[model samples]
Target: MDTSKATGNNAPRNLTKGEATRRRILDAARKVFSENPYHAASVRMVGKAGGFDHPIIHYYFPKKAGLFECVMEEHVVEFRTFMEHWFDGLDAYTTDKGLAVFIERIIAFHIANKDLFRTLMQNTAHVENFDQFPASAQYEVFHDSFLKTFRKKVHHNASDEEVSKFVYSFTVLAANYLGASSTYARFLGMEGECDAYWDWVKETIHYLFLPRMEKIIFDSESK
Candidate 1:
């Protein structure tokens, strides 16, 4: 809270002091959490990175868990926007086009916000982020869209329990990969190239994963 601590354009307090301070803290936290994962992130460090004193961090987030919740809340909003914009007409989708778009959108979201997703995965510990994430409008958007679309598609072929398990498996696979991606970067050999990541995910989604999963889910009884 000390005016003396902030430097440069972050000088002291700006007009929207509260919002600016919150943004700065979140930005700093994103950087730290991205590099260190959830466990290593510290309030004091995020505060200092934001050009503020330690007390300010506590004043905003109260606890490390609370800060983590904020970060997830922000990202869930961004992700929900992407989903709603892309996953429209879920009821109309009977072909692979919808599923393909859904998968691509999710993968793109993961790539674009790898830092935030990394933090979330480390903290979530193989849980559905929606399960552990605090209740928010953003959560509602994602939860509803995903559940509705999934339930619709798998309705005739599988029981509700089966569908639920399937969804959990799917989410866990993606979340776990995102969590452990740093360790696999060399095999991925992306070297921080977004293109490489996309290429890998694109192939994984379409040729490798989609057809096989579709048959297992939609064609099991026919065979």
Candidate 2:
């Protein structure tokens, strides 16, 4: 069988109409999954959101899992591109600036795709074994590069396991913040504008988390 043409990112490019319908379903699925747990989300709901019949969803994605997998695959592609661009210039920044940039980019991406991030986080929390997923394999390459940069710039003594834990924690923290922006705004008695909240988050990460990590690195080195 003939394959689709490759896009700039090397993924198989879909034809115009096929791509449009696929994106519609994917967008609807993302909203559904973000709002409802994986088990609770239904193809009918996705169809309704996309203004299509359930049969269309079934045509594009034989099962809900297949649709979810496509969502993850798309996210992996975008994320890998983002990481590649960020990592390429990471060495140019000082430790403080590097951390700031990292936090900023992470938060920005999460906010831009808040629903998708929420869905991914929910899947991660419920799924027992992510290793079986092909998307996870692709992500591991970026993860390794991130760890290499982390070790080179900040914590030379930190093992891969330790760095992985830190990366996981940082990502979860950022994702949760973006996922619960309205709730946090209410708690803080602040305006609900995302730009303002993002500014506050960046400052908090820079001043609070960044300093604490830097201090820990300093203390460890002094030992």
Top TM-score model: 2
Question: Which segments of model 2 are wrong by more than 4 Å?
Answer: 1-16, 124-155, 215-223
lDDT of each: 0.60, 0.65
Where in model 1 is the C-alpha error above 4 Å? 1-15, 89-94, 126-145, 152-157, 216-223
Model 2 clashes, total count: 0
Error of 1 at 84 (Å): 2.7
| Poorest lDDT segment (10 consecutive residues) of candidate 1 | 1-10
User: What does candidate 2 score on TM?
Assistant: 0.73
Error of 1 at 5 (Å): 39
**C-alpha lDDT of residue 149 in model 1:** 63
Tens-digit per-residue lDDT, 84-192, candidate 1: 5444553365546545665666666666566645765565553446455443344354455566666654534656676666666666566555655655555777675
